[model samples]
Target: MFDSLNGNQLKKESVMLKKASIALMIVFLMVSVCSARVVDGVDMPETLQVGDAILVLNGVGTRTIAFVIKPYVGGLYLKNAETDAKKIMMADETMAIRLNIISSTGRGTMMNALRKGLRSSLDAMGGDFEMIRTRFDAFQEFFPEDKFEEGNFVDFAYLPGEGLKVYKNDGFVGLIEGIDFKQAFFGIWLNEPSPADSDLKTAMIAGDVSGEARAAQGQWLAKVDLEQEKKAAEAEAAALAKAAAEARAKEEAEQKRLAEEKAKAEAEAKKLAAAKPAPAKPVPAAAPAKAAAPAAATAVATMPAAANNALVAAFLVNAIKTSEQIAVQQGKPFDADAETRRILDMWSKIKAEVAK
Candidate 1:
């Protein structure tokens, strides 16, 4: 039905449709990007200037209610990627943390978590909680505006000589003075004890650096220790190999002795049989002389039994001699009672092979 349309008309329509679609995609991506700071949902700037010092986004994380309810988007900002939390805490360089409030409940809950994190950090630093009690009491003055509501952004900016600068929605709030305060407050999110905020710390350390670069910085000591462990393992393996070789040699000697004993027993049995005088008897007229055959059959039947006894005797002697040494290879004391029956069974198989 549309074949009647001009070629130019069709081309123009197609171009308009493509442009509209592209426009819509751009709008969606913009909305998504804004909602998610840095990425989507983490509202953070690549470089946020604090006083005279310009800082880069270290990482972005979300603080949730019961791990599901969205509360606030937290961001850690530093000069660059820093895997070590201690360096962040000790570094007098400018760094900032932002908590972008997403919900009304973020005020009380998120703040409480922050306070608890700071206290835990303080405890880790070995400071008396009461000594810093007043610092926190005075620190509560920043929240006086009752507008700790949604869409509010709070920043904790640290300057070397001036201490921490608190800001709300871009307006200057107040200052929490002292180097000790910075260590404890930063530690809350940067160190342990804040399981909920650990993700934020991780994101900050990761920054935009490659994984290999971060691992190199993080695992230098561990790599040194790993080399030591490898050397120790090699030495232990060489010792075990030496012990196993000695065991095999001892086992070979025992087997040779057993074979010699079996030969000796067989020879001695045959000699004794030959030395014994045969009793003479008159043969019956009807019966064929089978006396020589009976004697030969008797010797053959007894040969297997004698060989079996010799093998069993040799195995037992070896077991007794090597039990303690075998235990050393096992890295424990040898249990003679448990192994005796097993050795006997093995001896029986060897004897059976000889009989066959």
Candidate 2:
């Protein structure tokens, strides 16, 4: 009894020890997880007015951050903050202007996050992130102005062999030898020329050149010749219509000829059907022969054995011929005589009974 009691106490102690060890392990794991460091920093104003510098724990390793002073809520506000802070502030003020720092680390982190998020979002949106970046880059290069506005007309003329001339108000601004508008606006940074000054230059040189003498001459000649060409096209169309009508009439005559031939063939088929003999009917069983006459004698009297055998053979041949006719009618070819001979041999055994 004492030994059993001691064994029970030992088991209880073992279980308690296991629970304590498990609890200690769990605590250690939680502490280790809590001690890990993440990317942590404070959000501060990105830009400051003249003589104003905001101190921010710069995750990008920048010491001082500058900001532009802008009016907000009837008071002066600073612009050019970190993206996170800007997003939070802009959530309330929809019309607020914010400047992006565009640093290497900042852009990289933001772009990585954007890519990860867009992988799922892009499927729903039906576009790729790479395409979105490419389009954004193109938009920045093409139209650099903050807001688009209408400008005066600028005349750009390309000579036959000479370079292109840009004009504003009858004054020549510049000459371009080989410039492509699509490449200038849509090409990558390494290949495309800067467009910052191009817009301004184009705006200044608007409405400069008069119409070219050669261009005016070509336009007038094209207009006069176009009317004459239209009249010629109408005459040609009329001639074509007459020829088409003649061809249609010929086609109708040919169709009528084919119809008459088909009717004649059908009538010949009906005449042949009428001339063909009808199939022979099977004979009914004869009444019992006279009592005095033997069965064999009576059979011989009703039909000669040789002739009866021949008639059975003929009937079998007719059956095979009918089968062949059915196959032929169904667009299949068959050997009628070979099948008829096969049927005669098969019915030879039954010929004696049939003759009787």
Candidate 3:
């Protein structure tokens, strides 16, 4: 079913298809080049004329907030590309920091960010810090009373004698006069060790980012992570120390509790003793006849004066003992062991008084 074309027809068709493909590719490349040069919807001029000198676009980047919202896109222009921030600030050549506002509601936020940036940059230079802060505070008044809306352009340009010229959307906002102030102002977005500024400064310095700048950036990130780990370790140690102290307190409390319990047990034993009734007096033994000479003499000699009233009783106990012995011998009430123990207990009490 092939309506077979000639070899010449097939060759011409293939060539036409290839030409169409090439045309499309060329158009796509052109579009990409055009768009790539534009920054944050604002097209940057290749050269910017400030006063008499022309500054070139050294680098461009977005100022992102919280890694999500972009409040502005910033571009740095310089007479010559310089990666060292101090050199850029002190070059005594014309340079500009251009910002295209992308968020209308972030004027206060932007101001705070600028203040923080200025502080960060000023911290690097160790002289007249209070003067530097005062200068930047005055510089803040140059902004419009109304918060900056989207699409507004703020440009800061520095010339040797003219100082820092401020322009808002191509209109004049006035200038702060001094190279000293210029260095601190530009530092806000050009200094190192900053989360945003370092990257932006590096990109701005070299139109095409170099490996050296990236390396510095890598080291900064590593330092940040290291500091975070150190803080985490300190916090963990604090928690452990607190726990150990709590355990020691609990152990001491338990020991005290056991001591109190032992004291209570001793008090209870004393109370039980105090509650007991006194013993009843023993009954007097039966009366007896006068004994033999040996027994009488021993009783009179060993007896105490305290037992003067009990002599009769002691003699009666001896009589009872004799009766018990007689009863045992006659087998009438034969408990010899009990009878002897009773006689010994009675005699021992009387003897204890005598010894005392």
Candidate 1 local Cα displacement, residue 351, angstroms: 99
Q: Write one digit per residue (lDDT tens) for candidate 3, span 121-221.
A: 67766535577676666777887465878888889999887889999988888888878788877777766555355556666766553233333334434
**What would the TM-score be for candidate 1 when compared with the true structure?**
0.46
**lDDT, candidate 2, 260-332, per-residue tens:** 9999999999999999999989889998864343222332343324656677555555566566666666666
Q: What is candidate 1's local distance difference test score?
A: 0.65
Distance (Å) between predicted and true CA of 277, model 3? Answer: 99
Candidate 2 — which residues are off by over 4 angstroms? Answer: 1-224, 293-356
Return the TM-score for candidate 2, rounded to 2 decimals: 0.19
Among all windows of ten consecutive residues in candidate 1, which has the lowest summed lDDT? 291-300
Per-residue lDDT of 270-336 in model 1, one digit per residue for the tens?
9999999989897767866443322222223333355466764664656544655545655666666
Residue 219 lDDT in candidate 3: 41
TM-score of each: 0.46, 0.19, 0.46
Q: How accurate is candidate 2 locally (lDDT)?
A: 0.36
Model 3 residue-pair collision total: 1
